[model samples]
Target: MTAPYLIIFDVDGTLIDSQAHIVASMEAAFSGLDLPAPSRAQTLSIVGLSLPVAMLRLAPDHSAEMRADLVEGYKAAFQSLRLSADGAALSPLFEGAMSVLETLQADPRFVLAIATGKSRRGMEHILDQHGLRPYFASVQVADDHPSKPHPAMVKACLFECDVPAARAVVIGDTTYDVEMAKAAGAQAIGVSWGYHSVEDLRQSGADPILRRFGELPAALERIWSLT
Candidate 1:
């Protein structure tokens, strides 16, 4: 029998290393709002969550008014920084990311999509800027549905791709991604190159955390074998 279709990736740390921009923007946001900013390590831990979720984690004691203010401040600061960088805000894609996508896209049995916490507009901007837009068949973004740790985003991607949950795998750098995949009844594959440590990912219930991007195709082949 043919192997099952596989792979939905989280964009931020999984494909592209945007941690610097993210943390900088977040720090700027906190400064603008006069709120205490989370440290880089703290911010990294919440990377896969939605903006609101990240804010809540960073400022759990914030009032509703404060939350609104912080959100607005964050958007303004982030946009300003991104614009000031002249489109250079994005970090480079992980090593072999393009090659892995190309290899998988070339295979008829494999399918690829994006499941990310970034807003649809945000994700589109990054993908288009990097000339990576055409590679994904479907994109599941925060604006389109609920955020990570919730299966809605992954479920939407599964629906868009017309694939059963059992045939799909979610690959990401954070624990939130693993939990979301588990909630969706899909396999979870974690990449050690991203924000979270390998031990953290393992504790998050990711099966077989991969140390390098080059191992992805073979790792995925193994997941597909089960379905």
Candidate 2:
């Protein structure tokens, strides 16, 4: 019998296309303080980091107090956007994402989990919004772990799912995800449809960089076959 392999995913850029909401909320947060907003590029670049860390990077010259305020502003703005009628459009699933997840979830050889930088509340909202709550075996969020590029989240998922690091794969759109999975002693697969470029993902040590969500099954097969 084949051993069960765990597939851990990153949410923001991997499964959900939330860039519009993210950029708008970031702009609103800065505007609330009369500060110059980060460019769309600037904001998207920090998508895989925790809110506090992201604010620190974007506003390095500001005092800690100011950064804290920006975090609150951003949270408020994001929550408001999430509750609005247009929320579905604000953060829809990427193309082929639903079908791919469904297929994976039905496979007995694999287990699915999520490790994301989203707050617990935000992660729950996304899960419920996309009917994804039941699909994941374990869900690690920023509320309980350090930001990405750290192995803490991935380690927790492995522990919960009872999967060895060698048999686990982290699929994400950012270099942060690649680094995190590597730090956790797991394989990393990059996705091209996210915030970071494919070259960046490759340089950061991700293998079998997938061009579409549908390509995941073969990527997983390639990674796990080596182990």
Candidate 3:
């Protein structure tokens, strides 16, 4: 029998194009708190971080209580948006995302999972909306683990899926994701369509950054072969 391999995806920038909804919700959160909203670049800079971590980075001078309030504000704003017709359309799967997911899930050699900075409720909502819940065997989120670059999420996925680091891979769009994969001793593949630059991903130790979703299979094969 062939050895099993695990492919872990990052939700925000990797599978879902959620930046618009995220940024809008963040702005609303700040507005609700009567605080200044960070610029798009500043907000996107901390895309893969946990809510509190992201908020703290964006407003370092803000007190811990302020950060907690911002977190709740952002969640409320995002939830409100999700109820709207326009916000209901938030996070469409990226081009070719469904294609790759379908193909991989149907293959016997691969076990799929998600490690994301999203709250479990939010992650479940998106997965259910996209009809993607059945595809992933494990779903790791900030509600249960630390933020990206901490390796906790990836380690949890590996443990749940019974996949060794050598046979596990993380595909994401940020430097945080790359660092997490490295810390977990798993191969990292960076997708270019997301927030971070290719140079940043490379600097974070991603090998052969994927320029498009269609390249994912080849990238995985190359990663496995080179190992």
Candidate 4:
């Protein structure tokens, strides 16, 4: 049998549509500090980064202390929103996401994994909510690794799964994901439905950019076929 290929997915913008909660929590965090919130685009642009790094980029003019406070505030606000009565609606899986995951889960040639900037608790909540905990053979979160574009998270996931970078692919909706995968010597596939633009994904070296979730399986096959 061929060695099982590792397919590492990024969580927030890629698999889960958490934009509603993400933007609202960012606004609430800024409001709590009497600071103006970042615009929706600005907030979304930093979606794949760790909270601290995201705050720095979004609120660059603010003091480190202020940014630190924003980090805590955002975490609290996001958790609150997650536990709200309509939380499930605030972060639904993208259309066709579940079906594709199910398909991949049944494929013996692939081993699924997660690499994301979300905290372990936050990622866990999402997994539990969507019954996705079993879909991933390995999970790497921001709590344990440096932020994206650093390659640590992807490298860690590859390590834990005992899969070589050449036999793995990273799928996400952001330039950070593309860069991270490239830095780790893994191929990257970008999803257009996520926060980042398709042009950005292309510029960052993602090939076979997927226009929708349904196209993923074919894209994966195409990628591996060329290797």
**Considering every candidate listed, which one attains the maximal lDDT?**
2
**Alpha carbon deviation, residue 49, candidate 4 (Å):** 0.2
Query: Cα lDDT of all candidates, in order?
Result: 0.84, 0.95, 0.91, 0.94
In the order shown, what is each candidate's alpha-carbon RMSD?
2.0, 1.4, 1.4, 1.3
Model 1 lDDT tens row, 1-227: 64448589999889988888788878888887767788999988888888887888888898867776776777776667667755464567889999988998998887888999987767877787778887898888888778788999888878888889988999999999999999999999999999988888899999879988999889887766733
Q: In candidate 2, what are the lDDT values of residues 72-148, reduced to their tens digit? A: 99999999999999988999999999999999999889899999999999999999999998899999999899988
Q: Write the per-residue lDDT of candidate 4 for residues 85-179, one digit (tens) a residue.
A: 99899999999999999999998889999999999999999999999988999999999999998999989888888889999999999999999
Quality of model 3 by C-alpha lDDT: 0.91
lDDT by residue for model 3 (1-227), tens: 55589999999989999999999999999998899899999988899999999998998998999999999999998988887898657878999999999988887889999999999889988988899988999999999888889999999999999989989999999999999999999989999999999999999898879988999887777777843
Measured with C-alpha atoms, the lDDT of residue 47 in candidate 4 is: 96
What C-alpha lDDT, on a 0 to 100 scale, does residue 168 get in candidate 4? 94
Judge candidate 4 against the unseen true structure and give its global Cα lDDT, from 0 to 1: 0.94
Colliding residue pairs in candidate 4: none
